[model samples]
Target: MAHTIQGKKQLLTRVRRIKGQAEGLERALNAETECLAILQQIAAIRGAVNGLMAEVLEGHIRTHLGAHDISETQRDNDMEAVVAALRSYLK
Candidate 1:
């Protein structure tokens, strides 16, 4: 199913922010930042990415899957895809 353009834009913004965080990390590393500080930054970035994934997954499940016209096969596939994504990220 196609997602709304607005939803796509939101996800894109999140991904861009995560990309910026990664670049910031590279800069931190190059500057020889403190180990603890670097670790904290990494953790923060991970959390942000995880949060974004969760949001997208939630939207997919609640919106696309909830549509009354969706066939059982498509629903199952979408649900499975969400589960797989969640597992990958949680790991």
Candidate 2:
């Protein structure tokens, strides 16, 4: 995908925050945090990551699937990829 300034900025911010959250989780583990607290943090990180994935998939649908230039086959492939990702993520 071609990089637009806005897309790049948004993705970079999301990825950086996810990285920070992952590091915080590691620190919590290393510090022997309470099981409940650690699990809560892990769950929060997972939600954040999933939300980011959804946002990217939405953009893919709009930019690629909705584009007039793309063929029907390509659009179907994109939708299939999104559905496969959603199923995997939901599992």
Candidate 3:
């Protein structure tokens, strides 16, 4: 992700936070927290993951395709792939 080096620190920070969140979830599981609370944690984790994905996707577009080296067809295909990914992820 040399092209994304500028955002690397921010991305790593987000990942570290996610790791902490995951550890907390594990602790909650070990402590047998309420089912509702566990579900909420899971939802929060999912949202964090989705947010990370969006940032990476944004970087990919701006760094790779933005260089204008690829053909229009290739660019369109890449965008379609991004859309497909989002669709599956949201489902």
Question: TM-score of every model?
Answer: 0.82, 0.82, 0.76
Displacement of residue 85 (Cα, Å) in model 3 is: 5.8
Question: Which pairs of residues clash in candidate 2, taking residues 3 or more apart in a chain or in different chains?
Answer: none
lDDT tens readout by residue for model 3, 1-91: 5646888888999899899889999999999999999999999988898899889888887876686788889888878887898899779
Off by over 4 Å in 2: 3-5
Q: Per-residue lDDT for 64 in model 3?
A: 61
TM-score for predicted model 1 compared with the true structure = 0.82
Q: Assess each prediction's global lDDT (C-alpha) against the native.
A: 0.84, 0.84, 0.86
State the lDDT of candidate 2 residue by residue for 1-91, as single tens digits: 6533458888888889989999998999999999998999899889889878877877777787788998889889988987898899889
Better of 2 and 3 by lDDT: 3
- What order do you get sorting by lDDT, best first? 3, 2, 1
Cα lDDT, model 1, residue 4: 41
Q: List the residue pairs that clash in candidate 3.
A: none
